[model samples]
Target: MSPFLTFKTFYTNPLNIEYFYIFLFTFLLALSLIAITYISGKIIKADKTHMAAMLLGCVFPNSGNYGAPVALFAFGAMAFDYAVIIMVIHAFLINSIGIFIASFGSEKSTTAREAMQRVIRMPVLYGALLGVLFQLLHFKLPPTIMEGISLVASATIPTVMLILGMQLAEIKPQLFALRYVNSVTVIRMVISPLLAALFVIFMPVSDTLKSVYILLAAMPVAANTTMLAIQFDVKPNLVSFTTFVTTLLSLLTIPLTIYILNMM
Candidate 1:
């Protein structure tokens, strides 16, 4: 509802056509990474649940509050706008595809068709679709109603954070999988953005937008991954722990990535 109402204003500005390229880049890159992450799990015969947690950790990014601020500070307001576009696209995908993947890894076994069927039934899908429709229709919700939707949408993050705190309280030494944690961290902080940098080389956007894309690609594993792990009862400890570690590690890697981009 929030994303739906919020997206209604999406056309009222100097929004770039290049934004499509950025969305394409983010969507394709995420799916590619997820596929590789899943296949790697298969090669190692990982438990389905653990693999789901790792998939979330390795692919989904912190593009909302985290990536947006970094964009504002790192490259100023214009880059922040680009980052927000990326974040919106990312938020929709994570809510849909991410949810489906999490469901598949739960105790009840599910097939791809079933998982996709479940995804189709998600409200976020409709929210996004209606948003697109409303945008096309030049529709506007009354301000009060839009405000109500926005209020509900705003609560989502704090709730996800509260979930993170609860998951953190459950963390114990036995729950930490250092090998998987390190792998997720390396991929999230290093390889993913490196791939993005290469990918954007031929992209139609300017170098600045390209750099913005790379910085976002380097964001930590999303805290929402923790929420999904908790929701599905799928190795909540490992997923949250990886989220924490990747976030802490990003403090160092983000600056290094920035410097590397400068060199490029």
Candidate 2:
């Protein structure tokens, strides 16, 4: 279950204006990455499928499963709140803009209107929206129901980890292409965090929140991206391979990113 459905920890609180900074920062991050990927694709004369894979790998990140836990451990429970807020924003952007990119990259060839129709049909986007709407109306689910929803949400971590493993396992080692894999990993693991570090400098937020955002941006190529690539037939192998490589690279990059942020 997507955490967006969790009524309590996720959306029960009234919306905070401070959250806008998180939204803005992530939006800028996604836009910058999309531009970089798109422009770089044009430079390399790459096809739409490969560019889409690059966009997914570079723009969206594994903020939910990988990043949230890292925040809890690295900065204590306080920073975890910042992480979830960012995760919610990430989910919305990825599900909406991500669908557009995937559909555009598909061999079936879609019109712009058709792409938006796909985005609208996504239930996850509606879940998040409905959650926000409920919050604005000061509506709360009964405690008995909230507990049941929380129970399902609690299972998300383990289930997602299992799915992550399954996705990686399905990748054929022989099909791995080094040059493209390196390209995506460098953008995801290196460039994304640097851009985040700079983005947070001007954001009106606590230092702790800034650090949390940077670390989340520094996370690996999103696991969700591989599934999207597979579904759209948009270089699934390259996306999967890049996901695998960036994840392995994060073991080094995350710790280093944390250390550098602390020094600042």
Candidate 3:
């Protein structure tokens, strides 16, 4: 079959329901983490330290920087819409929800107003908004402009990967203990994607959408998690480790997800 036919076939297949399952699972999983943190903070009377780490792991995924590149390579022009959807979801979560959670245990004690400001300042939001505006206006960027933007966006992935590797190489020995870091790695790299895949299976979205959602869910933790950790005085080392391990392990997990997607 031709590439388009293959995609069409994959999308139309009944197993495509798995996409909705995955999306819901990932979404619920993040929400659950927020609830857990809030409860732990209130009842268990836990300190902000643990809550911070889990929050970072729960919310951050390398959907835009890495997933977009992979989707473009695999899905061609369709990747643009997929990337947009992922960005929209991400912006909503991070701006409205993730920012609220991140504000806690943070020295700056960000109010709702401050969080809204931060949300507005997000570069990904800006880029996605402009891209969508141009798209909706039926305005095509000049070839040169399009090429320049694509070129810059294209570099985001590999550079991030290399930086992640280098960052992992620099991790402190104390931070490598299984007791402190193993659960974060497993949850971020393994459980999160598995749940996302299952969630995608049940949603009413299109088959292509299912595939895109699965791909986004399976992505590694976002590098931005570390930045958030640093900015909020969370467990930066733990967040960085989770990001590193997930990104590294994704070499295997992502291919498996692709195989499963093909079968579906």
Model 1, runs deviating above 4 Å: 1-9, 108-174
Residues 73-163 of candidate 1 have per-residue lDDT tens digits of: 7887677667766777787778778887788789755466865665566554466566666667877678897776667754654554455
The total of clashing pairs for model 3 equals 19
Kindly list the per-residue Cα lDDT of model 3 for residues 1-264, writing each as its tens digit: 112222222232233444344445556857754664455445544467766676677556777567766776766656545554564456557666666666775776878898788777765555545554554566655778655555665455577557656666775544554643555566666666676667766676667767777677678877766777778777777777777777788899888887788788
The residue pairs found clashing in candidate 2 are none
| Model 3 spans > 4 angstroms off | 1-29, 32-46, 139-170
lDDT scores of the candidates, listed in order: 0.74, 0.79, 0.63
Write the residue-wise lDDT of candidate 2 on 81-184 in tens digits: 67777887887777778877887788866667865776677655666677777788778788898788778866766776677777777766556555567678
Error of 2 at 185 (Å): 1.0
Every model's TM-score = 0.76, 0.87, 0.73
Better of 1 and 2 by TM-score: 2
* Model 2 bad stretches (over 4 Å): 3-6, 121-123, 175-177
Best model per lDDT: 2
